[model samples]
Target chain A: MENLYDVVIIGAGPAGLAAGLYSARAKMKTLILEKDKAGGQIVTTNEVANYPGSIDDATGPSLVARMVEQAESFGAERKKDEIVKVELQDKIKVVTGEKDVYKAKVVIIATGASPRYLGVPGERELTGKGVSYCATCDADFFTDLEVYVIGGGDTAVEEAMYLTKFARKVTVVHRRDELRAAKSIREKAFNNEKMAFIWDSVVEEIKGDGIVEKLVLKNKKTGEITEIDAPEEDGTFGIFPFVGYIPKSELFKDFLETDKGGYLITDPDMKTAVPGVFAAGDIRHKSLRQVVTAVADGAIAAVQAEKYIENTFEN
Target chain B: MVILEKDNFEEEVLNSKGLVIVDFWSDGCEPCKALMPEVEALAEKYEGKVKFCKLNITKARRLAISQRVMGLPTILLYKDGAKIEEVTKDEAKAANIEAMIEKHI
Candidate 1:
């Protein structure tokens, strides 16, 4: 009973923190576990304009800090523990973390997702050396230097514009001729003085000595080859890829019902296939993954979890 | 927590007994600041079992360079003073760090 709780939410992102706010406010013995920092993907973001009623000068870190404060105010106990395993077949579920074991009547999985890599050669070796996934975190490193951005989505186009503030020029390389981003975003990128485009192409390899010096590109359609090398005077350049994200749902892969993309499958109410288990946020199978949708999922899951506890344990 | 420097890294971490975690960090890195809270909590939680130390690269560039640490917020897990595992980039989170340390202890 030392580590027992009425509800345990896994993750501390927008979804998990919102669930914690509701779960603890309902007076349930709630605990939220975040293996990494509490903010999840939002921590790496720079601008956050879509969130309704967001504060002035709202940034990813600022918004996450406010969400954490809200959850804490509701008395949700937060901990930093990496959960290694779980047991949810019985009436009471058990979770094993690196530090200790925790038991709970209901469990919410909101672990969210992370950026996906192209898995090409030298991508791993040159990361943090010149290749970066987040322009917000590493754009300053590329000041007055040339940069290459991969992907054609809204995030890619938007981040390309953001990178223009520091990089002297940013060339977006995509596998398709047209961008998949919204019209407004595409227009913004097109209008940017520093933005350039390389269509129907993908990166083959990245190379450098102690840093990123050059990139090898392949034209998918024609099978032609091209390369971009750093200026001799500069010695190195930057490459940012906003390819996409992959769900972080490996922990429950064996038990939870996931989609073809490996996102957790849940009912409209956020209840998973399991009787006492639920999933929410970007980790759950959904059409759109955004802060608003994630927060909505969190609220629903916590309410459903509260109902499950009352119906199963109290009655 | 112990402050790591070129002069004391050998005596304080290398010569020490049991598992030790040497965290390499810089001042301007946002991730390093975000992780400090959890580091304090974990060090307290594992007080008697493991030793935690930190080295600011600006202050101890020689020690950091010798380890081949190319990024900020890099964590090296040492068992009885030898490097066993290193975490950087996305893998350098609180949970992964704890799990790696648990392996050594």
Candidate 2:
């Protein structure tokens, strides 16, 4: 028989975990389903200084470990299963996973977002070898080495600054003449001695043999192409792409209302247009998508879910 | 404590007094992201009188499916926690949302 739950949460990221914590603590039979490993984006991040009341030594994994422990302690059952489909119209919600099918009275979603990559040559092959999307994860490997950063956004500029702590020098390459980052961050990058800019430029291709050894740069304004060789001392360098992120919501395209870029919408209470559905975390269409905000969304979603079950299913 | 899961969202919001507005959106939706500030503005504008919230479909696929949301950026309005109106993509403008809130509040 399929085990029935009071709440079934998708994804084990901060939002999902938070929802699990709140729901289970409220005495709801909650189950958290994660497609892969838990921790979400925090697993790839190195430092987490912004979370309020967080420990000073809190790294991404460390914080997530604590959250997981907390949620488990509160009686939230977690399983590693990819949800394939769902039947949510009835009073009881059914979630079908790759391994098993489960039922729940309520569901919370917190899948989070995935990194967007530059689809250039050698990118897919050289990932983790020399090419990376997160500077915090790969910065230590490139101590005193030169690094190239793509994009002109706040994340790009901030990551470039973070890279300066380990990299010998950091070069920012943008397709436009000017950076699109905030003025303060741009000013900080400008003042940093280790930071340099390649304006009106785009990375046409990433080339290397087993590792990144050279880059093919294209001047957008002038259309000039040049192959910049890696420094001889290191034989190779790191390339960090800070282009953007795409939400992992392909499975939901058919049912959910999405925007042009495919983000999900929600009201302030985290409820969907449909009577019994709710959403939360980075997956929601929100302006700021930090860890703090995701956790907040989870807490709110859990509370709402509790009330939903109590009133409608009390009979 | 409130648990905002799929089963209980309707009861929680509808049972509460005053206007209840729900924004349905997803990640990777540019226009949805663009309209966030406007939604937040509405939340702030009607803070004391109205209750506002958001639902992400990508993360909450089951919930979205249950609700029968068919597109990006749908909004729902509830009075006393029962859904009274649904705002389609074309009707998701701030003016319309505001008008809906005005009717309930």
Q: Write the per-residue lDDT of candidate 1 for residues A1-315, one digit (tens) a residue.
A: 677899999999999999999999999999999886788888767788789999877877888889999999989999878899999878899988988788999999999998899899999988867888867656666678899999999889888898899789999999999999999889889999999999999999999875788999999999999988899876778888889999999989899889998999999999988999999899999998988899899999999999999999996
- Which portions of model 2 show Cα errors greater than 4 Å? A182-184, B1-105
Candidate 2 chain A: worst-modelled 10 consecutive residues by lDDT: A134-143
Model 2 reaches an interface RMSD of: 16.8
- TM-score (C-alpha) between model 1 and the true structure: 0.84
lDDT of 1 at A64: 85
Query: What DockQ, on C-alphas, does every prediction get?
Result: 0.21, 0.01
TM-scores of the candidates in the order shown: 0.84, 0.70
Model 2, span A1-315: residue lDDT tens? 359899999999899999999999999999999875688877656657679999896877778888999999999999977788987677788889878998988877788888788988888766755677756445655677899999999888888998899789999999898999989889999999999999998888888876688899999889999898989977778888888889877766567776777777888988766556678898899999888999899999999999998889896
lDDT for model 1 = 0.86
Distance from true location, Cα of A236 in model 2, Å: 1.7
Error of 1 at A281 (Å): 0.1
Alpha carbon deviation, residue A57, candidate 1 (Å): 1.9
